[model samples]
Target: MNDSVKKRNMKVYIGKIKVMVFERGVCMTECDILIKGEKVEPVKEFVYLGSLFAYDGKHNTDIERRVNGALLAIMNSKSDSREARLAVHNGVLNPIYMYGSESWMWQKKHESGINAVAMPPLRSVWCLIKINIKTVMLESGMA
Candidate 1:
């Protein structure tokens, strides 16, 4: 590792080294990894590059976090025009929820999860409280 770093003229920040071990679908807490005689701390989960990574290699927590973030963005936005709010939903909220999505393994539950969170904001944008989701999606050009 040191030789590769030297060859690439790259520096490894020891303070940022972390170890997370997964075995047989379970996170191991007893494992100790050492780098340059320094003990690397083990973490159950951590956010790296704006995406949450967990020990079990599941995206549930990350999905929940993204949903919450998008919801917060919707709640904080003060646009009175439906067009402006729609733009915010398509621009800001979509990116926030869909970041790093290319690497995600598509699942039925994930689609349902996204749709469940997507409706309320669309409803708010269209000022419709009792309309069907299909109408909302069609009107918003999201279907």
Candidate 2:
């Protein structure tokens, strides 16, 4: 390979390298990782392609991160119309929270967490106050 091409490839590889160890429910401490004589820093958890991965093989941190991201997106939405807000929830928020959900180990607490994140913005979209969850779900067509 050409010298310039080799240099560029090296720079790209070095800049993007990270080390993570997944122990199948065990949390491991950081350890040094070396590639081509360069030390790569180990991480307990890291975000990759907008999803969080941890050493303990749990989805709780990723779920929380996704919920927070969705909440932030909904709160920042500029639409005033209920239809538009609902559209944002369907189009933007759902994808944000549900990304990579198929691979997650399903659990009741995760469901509850997702619902807790989902309902408040929906209530605001429907101009609801002190209404019960069943009513909210029905009005939102989510029941």
Global lDDT for candidate 2?
A: 0.68
TM-score of each: 0.57, 0.55
In model 2, pairs of residues that clash are none
C-alpha lDDT values of all predictions: 0.69, 0.68
lDDT of 1 by residue, 1-143 (tens): 66777889987887888887644466465886666667888888776546666776664436556656636665446655668788877877767666777756556777777777777787777776787988777876667
lDDT at residue 74 of model 2 (Cα atoms)? 57
Where is model 2 more than 4 Å wrong at Cα? 1-46, 60-79
Candidate 2 per-residue lDDT over residues 40-103, each given as its tens digit: 7777877755666677766444555665653666554556677888877777776766777775
Candidate with the greatest TM-score versus the true structure: 1
